[model samples]
Target: MLHALAEQNTPEVRKQARRYAEQRIPLLRGACVPVSKQTPRDLVDDAITDIFLGDGDPWDPNQCDLLTHLRGAILKRTWLEIRHRKLVRYSPFDLAEGDVETVLARERPHASRGDISPIVFASMIELVATELRKIETRDGPAQVILECWQVGFVERREVMLLTGLDDETYKLARERILLRKKYLPPRLVAIVEDLLDRSA
Candidate 1:
């Protein structure tokens, strides 16, 4: 089928490819974290456009099936979108900014140019540690929230599959987590808010 898609430069071929792409939509839904700037449908549209364009077909009879290839493509696009947003959100990483590199170079004068500066790395670690500490509460809702945000268990059904919780239990845990956030420290709440925003 993919061979036909690759060979035929016709409208029918393109339509068929779009149809095939649509079939894999369910696999992408909740499989990837949501992009703040775009809907999942938009990302799916981008994936289909990639297929219709010259990006690799990714189908291999000997290696894997069509849905698997499409799933990988969807995931790839998700990460690409997130990284692009991250660059925009953290513009200091832009090499075009004058004196930024000089400051970093001065701070890490002994480090090789390829290595990430210790200052930047340490800040990232601090952010992660702070957030993790807040979420490591005695109640188990933190685990649920972290699993959903960090481990790609974005859907309640998916979390249920891994934790073996019933639908009602999962729903209650999610609600409890949200309610608990109200009482958390402002800084911790801000971090959790950002995570929620990014994963939306």
Candidate 2:
């Protein structure tokens, strides 16, 4: 099964594999202490051990590197009692003001001259803004966006769309996509629409 998954090249297959890995890899929370018979408890514990301790043979090497790392981390990570520090709270809108064009240009030099598509950069900005909004509303922490980026969507395009790109880009969207609005905060609009769409 691991070998098959490792060799999987299709988008559909890899997407399914990503989803399976995320759903299957969960922390062992509450355990049923088997008092009468240690068999069931032992079996469950060993399975957990196999997953956390052993080399990730069940994970696809190419597609499941993150999964493998997470598994190893669960077992091998040392407990740290470092003092917690407050997160840098800034104007959520400040992220939008940070020279997006210059930043994108600096980070992706190929993006200039329509080489990398301006729409794609816009989509990323919108996505980041969406996460910032979550922090503003107390709906969830800003960290959730990073977490979702890590484990939820398999494809980068899928993530952009999930963040309300709708089409390949906001400009491609039929109606006045809030994401494409010049004056309005694209990230905030995307966040509201994304939440509303989910509820609907």
Candidate 3:
């Protein structure tokens, strides 16, 4: 039906698209966990557009029915959007003004009078950044991903889109970064581990 509709430009096809979108709105909304910046209707519309006009993989009727194929596409797009929202909004390194103090207090509870200097915290962050820069020297994607993170674009798809990196390159760059983390300062590692633990 989609292939046939793609060959024609008619009001009925447009109406059918709208009807399909309307019917899937509830399903999209339910599947879009944690809510996304794009509404369910928007996702449905975009999926319809991709199926009909985008250069994505052509829908295979032999593999699945239209609604089933649409459900898969809508869910995939919705999850990607949700993941983007989560990554953009939540960064382990985004230490607000007082967050550093809280971390110091927790990590250095035995310190003399809880007077951990902010300079120490700042240096830890810089050390981690420097280590990442070292990794960047070997992997261009590492640098691109870091820059993207600094500017609030951390989702895999968005990072790939912005940097024009394919999946394999991005995965390898990430693996390199993760591998380099073992060489980071112990204090920095401890701090990151603690942050991850708390976030989890």
Candidate 4:
């Protein structure tokens, strides 16, 4: 269906694209954190344009349906807009005590340079630490791993060595941590939503 639409520039294809964008606008808006000066309609239109023009990432029909592919593209565009806004709003004084490069080096030595603001990055780390601490309250191995991660020993081998966990145990602890994604606390969600709103 997507291929057929992309290959032609007929009035019917344009009408279909408009209808698809209209249908997806509300859903994409609700899912994405808001960006200043960019509306959900804008994102939807851009995604549709990219897909039809072959200017964005290549779409694979075998991998997913057209709707799913369109959603991914819109979300990707939203993320990029958010990052661009962050970069535009960033100031040296945002990290008055230290520089971005220094903080990035200390907190995440393995992470590559990206558009994420240092202040936002630190907030994300704190949020992760808060969730990890909740897990640690019930799981001993989680506590050990969390402690190791706090001190920047995040490599699997290093964490295992410091925590004295075998491969299976380490994997189990990691799995438990990953499972937290399905059950995020409401307070955390509210906090993140508020941050996004303010950022926008």
Q: Best-fitting candidate, measured by lDDT?
A: 4
Estimate the overall C-alpha local distance difference test score of candidate 4. Answer: 0.57
For model 4, residues 1-200, the per-residue Cα lDDT tens digits are 45654555456544554455444332223333344334544655676677777889877666655555666676566555545755565456334466534454444433223223345455554655566677857688877887887776766777998879999999999888878765655543544454445445
- Cα distance off (Å), candidate 3, residue 146: 1.8
> What are the RMSD figures for all models against the true structure?
12.6, 18.4, 13.7, 12.3
Model 4, backbone clash pairs (residues 3+ apart or across chains), number: 0
Full ranking by TM-score: 4, 3, 1, 2
List ranges where model 3 is wrong by over 4 Å: 1-117, 136-138, 190-200
Give every collision pair in model 2: none
What is residue 26's positional error in candidate 2, in angstroms? 22
Question: Candidate 3 on 34-111: residue-level lDDT in tens?
Answer: 323334446556666777785455677666555555556665565466456445543345344655436555545432
- Quote the lDDT for 137 in model 4: 71
How high is the lDDT of residue 71 in model 3? 56
lDDT by candidate, in order shown = 0.48, 0.35, 0.56, 0.57
RMSD from true fold, candidate 4 = 12.3
Candidate 1 achieves a global lDDT of 0.48
Model 4, stretches more than 4 Å misplaced? 1-38, 84-89, 92-125, 129-188, 191-200
Candidate 3, run of 10 with poorest lDDT: 26-35
In model 3, what lDDT does residue 194 have? Answer: 45
**Tens digits of per-residue lDDT for model 1 on 2-102?**
57434543555345445554443322221222333344446445554565575655444456444445555666665555456444543344233434334
* 70 Cα displacement, candidate 1 (Å): 13
